[model samples]
Structures are given as structure tokens and as C-alpha cells.
Target: MRRAAASVTIVTILLLLTGCWDRLPLRDLQMIDVIGIDQDEKEQGVTVDLIVTSLKGAGKGQGEPIAERTTLKGPSVIEAVGKTEYMDQGPFLAVNTRAFLMSESFASDKPVEEFKFLLHAPYTSINTPVIVYAGKMVELVNNKSSNRQAPIEKLHNFIKSLNSNGVINNISMHEFISSADEPLEDYPLPVVRYHESKFQIEGAMLFHSGRYAGKQITNEQLRMLMFMLGVDQGRQRITGSVSDSKSGLQDITYGFSVKNVRRSVHTQKGTDRLPMVTIRVRLNINVFDIGDNIDTLKPNYAVVMEKLLGKQFEQEAAGMIRTAQQANCDVLGIGKHIKAFHPKLWKSLDWRKDYPNITIAPKFDIQILNTDGFEQFQ
Candidate 1:
């Protein structure tokens, strides 16, 4: 009788545990791959663009689900997200979001405010990578142009290419959140634009605090910034113009295919009692292209060009450091070192003001290597 009673109790508990509850239908769950944010010029609000991949036929890479886009403009993020339910496309889900792209206006303005929805929203991953774009946010999120691959997959490949090529530094959503607060609040994100129906790195987007400090790093500056960040290894190609002394002020373009990059950095209190930082980069470069310059074929041109390149970068690095300081931005993240190793020093003064006056020393060692079938420029 005791055993039978115990069995009945267990059955009752099981029934209670399995009580009927509101559940989301599988067909109702839509997957969001990317979110693009742009400012509504007409209104004092933001336009949220979501790129969702239809999983109607998603399986084993055999067939592709269609890519659809939706946009909603609201004064706030939550309201905008809420308005999506009324759309004919149905309520969407961001749980499967792979990337987030924000426009210059949105990213630099109230970046934190723009993304706060993700923080409170259910099923959103904090690790989602954030990418910045200067072009039309809609054009970028519209990935239906390519028939070979889905837009999300193409964007993913672009990221891999960006990292491998060292176009600019990439940051994850979590990294931005982690550092967005403390001794280092400046976050530099990668930027891409739709060019020739393809995505290309435009530059690096700079932000101060949670708002835009009215600054951006792009073009040649972007390339130098990436190299200064010590991201010059792998199959990274450094392409830039260097003036040829023999060419009577004409600039010569050169492409250095870097096989390796070794870097070292240190921070200390200068004799002047200011933050002093030094960065040293040693690069093993394969001289790939020396455009319209006979000097590259010179017996000692490799050594000369290497030194010139190092010196040129030294000047370039100084300008970049100065620009960062003027903007009170710490893209290099040297503030962490000061806080970690010298707490007292960090506490003594305002880094924002002292940063501009801080001394930055950059030394680059460029070694030209010989590609067997090509030139012996090493």
C-alpha cells in the first residue's frame, strides 16, 4: 500500500511539472543575422534595419533560405523593436544574430542607448560582433544581390578576410561592453562599405565614451592604425605611397606582403611625470609591388626603402597618436597598462587631459625578404 501511494505521488508531481504553458511556435521564430542602425534625418530618432535569413529550406548547405530585410524607425530602440510585430513579415528573433552594423550617426551618437535593448532582451548574445559602416545602412544590410552565397555568409567571409588581410582591427560585442566602462572607454571598431556590390573596409570608427566624440579614422590612417596595432602578420599586405628622392617629389607606391610582425610595448611614468609609452614593431616584409620606381631594383634599395619606410611610419605613427590624444581617445589601450602597473600614477591625474601631452615613441624595423622566383630585395 505504501509503494502504491508513493507511485501515485510521483505521477502527480510529474503532471504538475508538465503544466500547459504558453510556448513559441517553431514557425513563428524568425532568425536575425544582422542589425543595422541609422539615424532618421527627418525625425529625432533612429531607423533600425534587421537582416533576417529565412530558414524555410535551410539544411546541409543544399539549399538557401531567402534573405529578407525590415526597417523600423522609432524614438527609442524598444519601441522600434516592438513595432516589428505589426509588420506583415511577422515578429522576428535576434537570438541567432551573428553581426550588428551601426551607422556613423547612430554608433557615434548614443551608441550605448542604441544597443541597450540587447542587454535586456531575451536570447540575445553579448558576444555578437559589431561592425560600423559609413554608407547607407540599408544598402549594406541588403544582401540579396549575390546569388552564390547568402548575405550573412558573405559578411562572415568579409570579416575573415578583413582579419587575415589586416585591413583594420575587429571588435566583438562583449569586448566593447567590457571596456566601454572603465579606465579605457574608447573603442575603435571596424568599418565596411558596399562597393561594387561587395563589402570593403572603409576604415576604423572611433568613439569616445558612449557617444561619438566627432572623430573617425579612415583611408591611409586606417592602414597605419592597423599596422601600429601590431596586426601586420599573416598574409597581411601593406600598400602605401612613399616619396622617391630620385623622382623629384613624385610619390611611389609600394606593397609589402608581411609574413611576420613582432611587437613590444611598454608604459612608464616619464621624467616629466606624464604617461610615456613606447611601441616597437619588427616586420618581415616580402616586397611584392614597387610601382614605377626603378630604385627598388637598386642593389641597396631594399635596405634604403626599409629604413625610409620605418621613418615614414614613425612620422605617421606620431600623427595618429596625436590625433587620438586630441580626441581624448585611447584606441591603443595604453590606459590599462597605466592602471594595472602604476595605480598611483593613474589616480594622480586625468588621463583625458594628460593623454595629449603624453610622449609616444614608435620604432619600426622593416626587413625586406626575397621571394624565390621574384626579386632578391632582402
Candidate 2:
């Protein structure tokens, strides 16, 4: 009799169980892949744009995903997102947002301020990657993928290739928050531009105290910057063409593929007791796309190539350091290094004012590994 009563109670419990009470069915939702925010100065408010992807088929078979776009305007970011409820197909699902962009004017002035909604919104993912769009917001939003693929998919692939591409670095939500919290380290974000109707990463956007001040570095310039940071190392270490004052862009000449780089930072006190930073860059390279009238296999030719490439790399690397310093951007985290290892030196001088005048000596030691001598047989 007890067993029968227990069985009856178990059946009653099982009958009362229900699944996914609050779950929203996928078919009823629209997925947003990209979110772009811009300032409407005329309206004195923020304008938000989103790219929503919708599948045409209703479970019969999969149909090609189509992009449905919507724009919302309000006095603030949160209000702008709230205004989306009145748009067709209802509000978008933030779960699919792959990339987020903000206008230069918005990000340059106060980036952390713009991220307030994401922080307070309990459901938003903290890992979502954010980028600053450097061009006109309208021009960027008007862009449809040139290759016929969705812009969201292209951006996703582009970010995945960042480490290998070497030209730029990605700034995710986590990176932004970390950099914002660190007072010494400046923020580094990938700058995007709509060029030739396609999205291209221009370079890194440097921000000091949340102000951009309209400064940017080019891709070639960023390569040297990353080299000195010693973070990229073997990946994306190839520098194309040595430029000359008279002619320009020596792509016909030898191109270098850098590998196995080692970097060290040293400091010394000058006569004025100011700190001096010396950067030593060591790398092995392969010579490819050899120019005409030059033989790489010859011992003398090899020496000349090494000297020429090393000197060129040194000059460019030094220029990159200066560029960063002139803008008062410490992308190298040199100040942090000084604080940790040379605390007295770091505290003695105002780094912001002295950074531009600091003596930064960059030395490049390059070794050529392959001469491509057997190319004729291959």
C-alpha cells in the first residue's frame, strides 16, 4: 500500500513538470548582427543603427538569410534602444550581435560613457567585440557587403584574422574595460573606414583620457609599433617594399618575412638624470621576391641586403615610436614598465610632458635565413 501511494505521488510530480516556460521560440525572433551608434548633433541626441538577419523559410527548408535594417534615434543610447520597440518586426535580439561600432565623434569624446547601457544590461555579453568607426556614420551604415555576403560575416572573419593580419589589433568589451581602468596605459582600438564600398581596417585609434584629438596611425606605421611591443612576433611580421626618397615603394626589390623576433627594453640615467629607453629588436628573415640585377646567394650581396634591411627597419621602427610619443600615446606600455622596474625614475618626471622629448633608441638586428637560390630548379 505504501509503494502504491509513493508511485501515485511520483506520477503526480512528473505530470506537473513543464519545460522552457519563459523561452521565446526562435521563429518569432529577429536576430541583430551589428549595432552602430552615432551622435545626432542637430537633434542633440544619439542615433542607433542595427543590422538584423532574418531567414525567409519557416522550417520547411533553410532559405538564404536576408538583412533587415532599422535606425532608432533618442536622447541617449538606452532610450535609442528602447525606441526600437516601435519598429517593424519588434525589437531585435541582442544575442546575435557580433560587432558593435560607434562614430568617431561619440567614441573620441567619451567612450566609456557610451558603454553604460551594456554594463547595466544584465543580459548583454561582456565579450562582444567593439570597434570605433572613423568615417561618417551614414556612409558606414549605407555599406552593404561588396562580396554579396553579409557585412556581419565579413567583419567576424576580419577580426578572427587580426593576429595573423598584423596590421591592427581588436578591442573587445573586456579590453576596453581593462584599459579604461588603467590610468597609465592608453586605449588601443581598431579604426574602421568604408573605402571603395568595402570595410577596411585603417589602423589603431589611440585615446588619452578618453579624448582622441583626431590622431591616427597608418598600417605600415602600426607594423613597426607592434614589432617594438614584441607581441606579434612571428605572425604578420612581413614588411613589404623599402621606400626611397627619390622613387618610392620598392616592391620590385626584396621583401622581408620576419620570424623569431626577440625584444628587450633597457633604461639608463642621462647627465640630467632623465631616463633613456633603448629597445633592442632581434629577428631572422627570409628574402623573397628578389629584385632584378641582385643576387642573394653571393656572400657580399647577402651582407648588403642585411645592412640595408636592418637600417630601414630601424628607421621605421624609430619613427613609429616617435609617432606614438608625439601623440602622447603610450601604446607600448613603457610607462608601466618604468613604474614596475624603475619606480624612482617613473615618479621623478611627468611622463606626458617628457615622453615627446625622451631619448628612445631602437636597434634592429636582422638575419636573412633563405636566399631562394634553388628557385630556377623548382
Q: Pick the candidate with the highest lDDT.
A: 1
Taken over the whole model, the C-alpha lDDT of each candidate is 0.71, 0.69
> lDDT by residue for model 2 over 92-173, one digit each (tens)?
3442466788887888767676665576563355577778887777775577642227455766676667645655556676
- Candidate 1 lands at a TM-score of 0.81
After the best TM-score superposition of candidate 1, give how far the Cα of residue 59 lies from its true spot, in angstroms.
Answer: 6.5
Measured against the true structure, the TM-scores of the candidates, in listed sequence, are 0.81, 0.81
lDDT of 1 by residue, 253-326 (tens): 88867777777787776798786789888878777675534433553666667777888888887777777777
Give candidate 2 misplaced runs (Cα > 4 Å).
Answer: 1-30, 54-64, 85-96, 145-148, 237-240, 243-252, 292-296, 372-378
